[model samples]
Target: MVGLLPRFRRYRLVLLGLFLLLPLALLLGAGLGAYPIPPLTIPEILLRGEGVEYQVLTALRFPRVLGAALVGALLALAGAVLQGLFRNPLVDPGLIGVSSGAALGAALFIVLIPGAGALETYALPLSAFLGGLAATLFLWQIARTPWGVQVSVLLLAGIALNALVGAGIGLLTFLATEQELRSLTFWTLGGFSALTWPLLLVGLPLALLALALLLPLARPLNALALGEREAFHLGVHLEDLKRRSVVGSALGVGVAVALAGGVGFLGLVAPHLFRLLAGPDHRYLLPGSALLGAILAVSADLLARTLAAPAEVPVGVVTALLGGPFFLYLVLRYKREVYRA
Candidate 1:
C-alpha cells in the first residue's frame, strides 16, 4: 500500500480534472449543433425562454446532451465493474450479452410496433431495458453451479447469446418495412438526435439504479484484485459481488443502448485509459471511467452532429472510429505484457 501512495496522489489530480471537464462537456454538447449557441451564453439563452434559440436549447439539445452523458457514464461504469469482477482487461458489458440483448429489443420494437403513442414511445426503451436485463439474468442462471458461477462459462454463454441476438435481428430486418428498416439502421449505427425528455425520463431512474448497485462494489472489487481465494479469505462475498456486477452492467448497457444504440468502445476505452494512468484501484477507476466516458461521448457526439452540417453521423460510428485504433494498441500491449509475465 505504501508503494501505491504516489499513484493515488496523481489519481486525485486526474479525478479533480475530470470532474471539471464533465460540465464543460455538457456545455459544449449543448452549445454546438445545427443551430449554434455560444457555450458561454447557454445559461442566458435558456433563461430568456421565448425565442427560437431558447426553444432549440431547451427542447432539443439539453435532453440529448444529458442523455449522452448519462449513457456514456453508465456504459463506462459498467465496464469498470465487469473488468474488475472478471479480472480480465478484455471484459466489458458486451461480454455478458446485455448490449446485444438490448439491441435486439430495440430492433424488435422498431420492426413490429406500429404506434407512435406515448405508451409506445415509453415502451420502446422499457422493452430494451428489460430485454438486456433478462438476457444477463438468464446467462447468470445458466452459468450458476453448486460450486459458484463459472466465469468461463458465463463468457461462453455471452458469446452464444450475442450470436443468437444477431440472428434474431437479421430476421427482424427481413420482416421490416423499408422505412422501419431505415430507422433501425440509423439506430444500430447510433445517434442522439432523437433523444428528448420523455425518453430521458424512461432511462433516468434505471441508470441511477445501475449506478447505485455498482458504486458500492468498489472496495470489494479492490479486495478481489488480490486473487479469488485471497479475497474470499479476506471476507469478500464473491458470489454477491458477481451477481450485482452482472445486474448493474445489464441495467447500464441496456439504458445506454436504448438511448444511443450500441455506442461502442467508450466502455472498453475509458476505464482502461484510467487504469493505465492511475493503476487499477476500483475506488478511482470506477468514477474516473464515468467522467472520462462522459467527456469522450460528448466530444464524439459533438463531432458527429457538426462535421457534416445538418447531416448527423451516428455517434456510435464516431466512437468506433476513435476507439478502434486505441483498442488495437491495447491488444498489442496486452500481448507484450503477457509475454513478459
Candidate 2:
C-alpha cells in the first residue's frame, strides 16, 4: 500500500490540474470571440456589468460556453459508462443510435408540430428524451441473446438504427418548408449559438444527476474488466449494473443531444484520451474525461466562432474535423483487439 501511494498521489495531481484548467479554458473561450475582450478586462467587465464587453459575455458568449461545457461533460460521461458497460473502447453514445434517434425526434417535433403555442417550449427536449430511451430499449432487446448481451450484435444493430433514423430525418427534411429545412440543417450540423439560460437551467440538473449516478459504478466497472462471469462470481450484480449504466448513459446523452444537437466525437475522443493519460481506472477516467471534454468543447466553440469570423462554423464540424482522423487511427490500431474481444 505504501508503494501504491505515489501512483495515487500522481492521479490526484493530474485531477487537480484538470479541475484548475477547466476554469481557465472557459475564461479563454468567453474572451476570445469576434469582439475579442482582453482576458484581464474580463474580470472588470464581469464585475461591473455595465459595458459592451459585459453584455456580450453575459448575454451571448457565457450561456453558450456554459452549455458547451455541460453538453461535453455529459457526452463524455455517457461514453465512458457505455464503453465500460459494453467492454468496448469504441463504443460511444452515438454508437447506440441515441443521438440519431434524438435528432429524429427533434426533427419530427420541428416539422410536424410547427408552431405548437406554449407547448412548443417543452416539445423538442421531451421528444428527444423519449426517442433516446426508445432507441436504448430497442437496442437492448435486439442485442440480448439467450446466453448474454452480444456486443457485436449491438454495434451492428445500432448502425442499422442510425441508418433508419437518418432516412427518417431525410424524409422530414424533404417535406419541410425552406425555413424549417434550414433550421434542421443548422441543428444537425450542431452549434451553441442558440443556447439560452432556460435550457441550461433544466439540462444542468439532469446532467449532474446522471454524473452522480455513474460515479458509484466505478468499482463495478473495474470488476467487469475481468469478464462478466468473473465479475458475477466476485459479487457484482451484472444485471443491475447494466440496467443503471444504460439508463444513466441514455439520460445524459439524451439531455445533451436535446440541448446541443448532435455534437459528435467528444464522447469517443475525450474518454480514450483520458484513458491513455490516466489509465483505465474508472475512478479517474470518469472525472478526467468530463473535465477534458468540457475543455475540448469550450475551446472548440471558441474556434468555431472565431475561425470564420463573421460566419461562425458549427461546433460539431470543428469536433468532427479534429476527432475523425483520431477515430480512424484508433480503429486501425485496435481493430484486431476489438474484433477478438
TM-score of every candidate relative to the true structure:
0.96, 0.92
Q: What lDDT tens digits, residue by residue, belong to model 2 across residues 131-204?
A: 88788889989988777667678788999999999899989999999878886888788888878788788778
Off by over 4 Å in 2: 1-6, 115-122, 143-153, 336-341
In model 1, how large is the Cα lDDT of residue 316?
88
Per-residue C-alpha lDDT of model 1 across residues 1-341, encoded as one tens digit per residue = 99778887999998998999899989999999888889998788777778988888889998988888998899899999988988888886798988888888888888878554666566777777778888888898989999999988999999999999999999999999898898788878888877899889878888899999998998999999899999999999889988889888888898898888878999999999888777788998999999988888988999999999788888989999988999999889999999999
Q: Which pairs in model 2 have colliding backbones? A: none
Task: Write down the lDDT of every candidate, Cα atoms only.
Answer: 0.88, 0.86
Output the lDDT of residue 31, model 1: 93
The TM-score that candidate 2 achieves is: 0.92
Clash count for each candidate, listed in order shown: 0, 0
What CA root-mean-square deviation does each model show from the true structure?
1.5, 2.4
